[model samples]
Target: MNDVESPIDLRNLKDALEWQETANVKRPWRKDFFDYYVDLIRPRSSDQCQILELGSGPGFLTQHLLSQLPNIEYTAFDFSAVMHQLAQEKLHASEKTRATYVVGSFKDAHWQNTLSQKYDFIIIHQALHELRHKRYAIEFHKTIRSLLKPNGCYLVCDHLCAPHAMQNDQLYMNKQEHLQALQQAAFKQIKIPLEIQGLCLFEMNVI
Candidate 1:
């Protein structure tokens, strides 16, 4: 069903599930990425850490994050209506979990302004390159730095697509570009051998 006639149809709930089902084999990458983040971010002496996961489709990565940091709170957000609904259903099943799901376009959402809370960690998985503006990524990076505590961390992971394939109008940030943006936003990149959903990890701290 995901291989529908139109791209719009592929964005539907059924297609989203189908796509996820097909991509299930890639969970190892996602797992590795999250593990790297958890290890690096090991919140020091904090009992109530918070995480903001961007593009939290179906809450797969979000669930793992929550399990790792049992006392931590989570705010999972996604742009797609179908994925947002799925995230709500998935997150709602947890009775004791302190997780919130928001349905809004990540491209231009007032997440920090509306929430008014800083996070110990912010994770962006398989979602960076989808942004249409490189400046947006930079702005978002700056936003994260501003919203993170002095010792807080941010993790961004995305597919290592063929270099040539990133030539489209939409600015798909390269690995170096990502690092530069993070650094410009006053973040320090920490090298780690991490992978997730075919993405390599770029962990940074807002020191």
Candidate 2:
């Protein structure tokens, strides 16, 4: 969290996770993002359900999710080893459920095979738009649907892009395109309460 430089790639994800003191500061608004996100999904998903979080930073919310839900199974994937170590320490310290952490990109070909089971609920908090390219985007959804056990819950919350590109290009998909893409993949979308910073949450039933 010092004045560390961002890694060339997500190799910094672990660093970001390990040194989250800076993350909360860098993105002060994300605290509210997590607050709104947890409030939206925690009550609906029981402990009996299986949940997966893609691009989890340090499992802070992962810890919260486990404690709030009933006998739940948790598997979180992050491409950062630093994050894996930090997450392990935090999760164990909290005495939360033993979480499965896989270290690799979401677009990796071996995901569905390694992940094995479909989730009852999948939450992507603030990490949806980081996915790289168009082909990878298509694969991302295909893999997401594969992880669903029929009508599984897909909760997504991400940035609201400005109408102009070059300036507000952090957003990978426009708000409307994001919705349309989900619908195209057969998700029944319902808009949930939004928080400050244009953070939107969608609860989609994977039918």
Candidate 3:
């Protein structure tokens, strides 16, 4: 697949909602991905962990996480206001209290400044490639690393471009390139907890 601009404008409410429905139907494995995240986070369920989700989209994962981990404080950061609205609508009144919605594009250098506090877990699922190009991966990973608290983990799952099922190199990288970016960002430890279909998930820590 070649690099192409997104056809749907997530900033539009109708488009955002349509995208949410389509994605859920087209990708059955998304539920599996969500469950995997919940399993990884289950270990920290007792603590009041701070979780930041980059490109949180329509809050499918946010709803899953908040419902599964009651004590976590979540910040859903996305660039589109309509996406934020859609996410908020999915959440209950109580979940809304525990979750904060922030609108900012990670493509901008100053995006990190919008967040006041560091997070125990920074997550991005099927969203990192929204940076629009692979060249920006390393610097973005560095920025994500800086936002993490001591002993915090960055959990990222994104599409990969590989020999068997190649994607646009400008938009997606292979597994090795993904690991290299995390390592170059100075993550002391990194592990690949999952890799299925076209997606790979990395669990990274600085300590």
Best by TM-score: 3
Q: Give the best candidate by lDDT.
A: 3
The window of 10 residues in a row where model 1 has the poorest summed lDDT is 1-10
lDDT of 3 by residue, 1-207 (tens): 344587778898889888988987866888888898888778976878999999999999999999888899999999999898888888888999999999999988789999999998999999988988888888999898789999888998998898755568888889889988888888757898887777788998768
Report clash pairs, candidate 2: 14-83, 47-70, 47-71
Evaluation by TM-score, superior candidate among 2 and 3: 3
User: Which clashing pairs does model 3 show?
Assistant: none
C-alpha lDDT of residue 185 in model 3: 82
Instruction: For candidate 2, write residues 1-207 as lDDT tens digits.
Output: 122233345467544644566756655776666666556566656546678888887777677666655566788888777776676777654445547887877756766676878888788887776564322454576578888887687777766654433124433566676777776676665666564456566677765
Alpha-carbon local distance difference test for all models: 0.66, 0.66, 0.88
TM-score of each: 0.79, 0.79, 0.94
Q: Show where candidate 1 strays beyond 4 Å.
A: 1-11, 41-46, 91-96, 109-111, 161-171, 189-192, 195-198
Model 1, C-alpha of 150: deviation from truth (Å): 2.2
